[model samples]
Target: MDRTLTTATTAKIADAATAGSAHAVGLAEWLTRRAARAPHKPALTCNGITWNYGELIERIERMSAVLAAGGVTPGARVGYLGLNDPMFVVVLFATARIGAICVPLNFRLSGQELAFIIGDAGVHTLVVGEEHIAVIDAVRTDLACHCFIHRGGAVPGWESADALMAGARAERSLPVAVPVRADDVAVIMYTSGTTGHPKGAMLTHGNFWANNLNEMFLWDMVSTDVTLNFAPMFHVGGLLCGSMATLLAGGHLMLQRAFDAEAVLHAVAAHRITVSFAVPAMLLFISQHAAFEAADLSSLRLIAVGGAPMPEPLLRLYGARNIPVHQGYGMTETASMITFLHPDRSSDKLGSSGTPPLMTEIKLIDASGEPVTAPGATGEICVRGANVMPGYWNRPEATQASFTPDGWFRSGDIGYRDAEGFLYVCDRIKDMVISGGENIYPAEVESVLYDHPDIAEVAVIGAPDARWGERVVAVVAPCPGKSITLEGLHAFAEGKLARYKLPKELRIVDALPRNSTGKVLKATLRVHNVATATGSP
Candidate 1:
């Protein structure tokens, strides 16, 4: 059966049974319930403005009316280009309330890239933030989207988002009633697409709801907790972990426009935030800053880190301060986290990404596609759960290729599980180097390199070789005012790594290029090496 047709049929049956009150369990309904349960509790805070649950719900309903008036129909795609502001959240829930799919475009993308996403998603209406007005204007002619709703700093011809909300509020109009089903797609998030063109991961309402349950159960979050969100909302990490999780718990969310080491520290101190989700690089910067030692982090109960591995030294630094750095492992396809190393076990299970939640199942498979049951046996990590995305939007072949015969979603990450079921990520399947018939996971070698005192950052990639098929190459970024030699690195890794696993070549660089989420762009590095050696522009 056609997916949209099935959804429409289900919605009709549900709406008829409950008189249009039977819309599926989605983020919009989640917010409505929270408002009814605790109307006076703080829902969101940003730019020094606070909104209680009742106020936030009212605004979302009005925004829904605005979208409805603008001709956004159920199942239509609505795009949002903005920073990490409250308006982003408002638009997110508002779209869901009216049964529209929300596509939040990456602000860091070039005009061409942004235009591609906007065009591909078939977004008829756009909500733009002040910071990205010029970017959208440049690509406006190239895009197929219509009806721009400016969030702030409005251009002369664009409609004011705030004015629309005020008008809706004054009119006291309710949102157009529509039946949104659980299986309906709520978001179409474009992946980073490290290898090729980006693909949009279609996350259904059920997928996101299951992910929220996983977070609340694994992290032990409660309604009283105050979470701080600094990551960009365009990413799944920020959307699910920072915003959705907090709201699902009926907790207050303190939003930051963007990440600044000092600003994050100040927000935590001022807001008495109980939890924060950051990338490993963000944690490293925060720990090394001067304000870190003086910042009052007494109220912080958890610091969950993801995007990349947390260096051992940084993990130890937080452990010494009586703080735990919980490691998380997931990707856009899994709706953020598939496993989370609990804070209490962070030290004991160092480098482990913990166990899957009650609703999820994880396993590994060898190259031949057989299951790896032996303890500590490495294989491609596969996940089975409701949290897994439905499929990549409009990419049927890619979507079919991403799953196993039995329906497990292939994670593309090579990893293993210990005797106790704790997951340890080895490396990406593409990143593992086969040198002279020996398999060398770069993450293992990189973990050892991180201990070198003179090395600030490191990325291990496989360079082409005539003798070994592939050679292990270490791209080193030196510590401030410090440098490292090839001999020094070998000496440091002598006992820590096997002979075949050691890096055979060292290339010094000032810094490694990272994406907005702080994961080193290894693909970019690989391309640069090839371009330089071949003298290609």
Candidate 2:
């Protein structure tokens, strides 16, 4: 595919985007407008099935009718539990069409854990993939959800998504897209919190639009771009970065259910994928795969990395292959992107998280709650932008505590800025762990393990891992005369916590180091364990 655009064409595309931004009220309207503009263009492909823009919109409208027929109304929460598939996108758009909120649950979570989020969100309708039906079934009795729709296959006591869509199509009439304002919530993404429970971040349609515009201006994504999406759609980085941006730009999407390093390489070569988003771990795995040296990656124009810093060695490896790695920084609250480092400066500003996006603002404040004006002064990173979420769902206290009185979102991250205004993140105030792009709150993991009979007292910390960016290390004071094994702890916490959040390394201490106020001195723990926090069973 030719990836060239003349000056006039570039200007024309920018103008079009600016004009569309003025009129597009929500995500549902974007698909309708795009289909009208390019009905025959391929929009999404997954599981050997391809859907053009025209067909895709029709499917969305049919799904919307199905949802409406099931009593789904504006402001209702609709949950989706699945991997990366076209139907996941369908549910997102379909929910947006009816002005309902889409709650994309992490498929990796345990059934009980999933129930808490579903109950907290008050989800009225849930759509589950076949692979996850058993998990949901185990917790069905505990949930107050009204409707359960299963995709991929039929299951007892569940509505068939395929059957519902077919019926809606046969009915010949589709529900009109609901009129929604820019500030209306499009998705309620749950982020694990320091309080040992997940908080749903209410991301508005305007937030998504702002992030999309930021990416379009920086990444220069075009309709000719073919993006391969293997990142889990449950995460904001996966849903809002390359996947939604590519669709908003009218590009083609090659959707994969999960990330497979070998498959990613093959797909990039065979399909000539031009743009993709991945975490550092995915990139590391891809570069280490046996096919890395032989795979053809000439078609790749940009590979965006987030969730963790891109190690310099991996950056050099990809740089040698002539593939530019665009490192970015953001969180679920920011709709996935805040600061973006263009590939041009990726090497020069090696450890920096780049500058704020076109419409985003980044500032650092010292411990005294004052702005740190001098370059290289360490402070807590704060953000202010249209792309930032308005607040957390139904958590007024959390919403208030997360923002300063002046309206800036407190990122709970410590970083410094260079003289050139580049952001360099150093530590997290909440001690959240980013293991392979998934956010794991140490408090949450510790809470689960505290219930273990063999564990008298426990504190979880993230230890540096070469491959996974960081590995969960459980520092424990075992019960008197009781020995705890890593396997035993894993088995104990198996159904209570997500597999990724499980302790990879266990450390036994006579007693955890604590300050006068009785808080665990995690810094001391990190200093001692980081060097030895290697090897996972």
Identify the candidate with maximal TM-score. Answer: 2
Report the poorest 10 consecutive residues by lDDT, candidate 1: 1-10
Which lDDT values do the candidates have, in the order given?
0.80, 0.88
Q: Can you write out model 1's per-residue Cα lDDT over 1-537, one digit (the tens) per residue?
A: 011222332343234334434554677876777666676689899989888876777677778999998989899999999899989988989999889999998886667667878887899899999888887887788987768998964578689998887777423465565667778999999874433356799999888888888888877888999999988889888888756878888999999998888998898888898888887667777887899998888888888777666667778887777666677887789998789888788778888998998778899999989999899999999999999997998889889989998999998888999999899997776576655434456776787789898999999888765445467888888899996777788788774554666677777788899999999999888778522121101
Candidate 1, residue 425: the lDDT equals 91
Residue pairs of candidate 2 with colliding backbone atoms: none
Residue 39 lDDT in candidate 1 = 68
TM-score for model 2? 0.95
- lDDT, residue 154, candidate 1: 52
Q: Which stretches of candidate 2 lie above 4 Å from their native place?
A: 1-23, 529-537
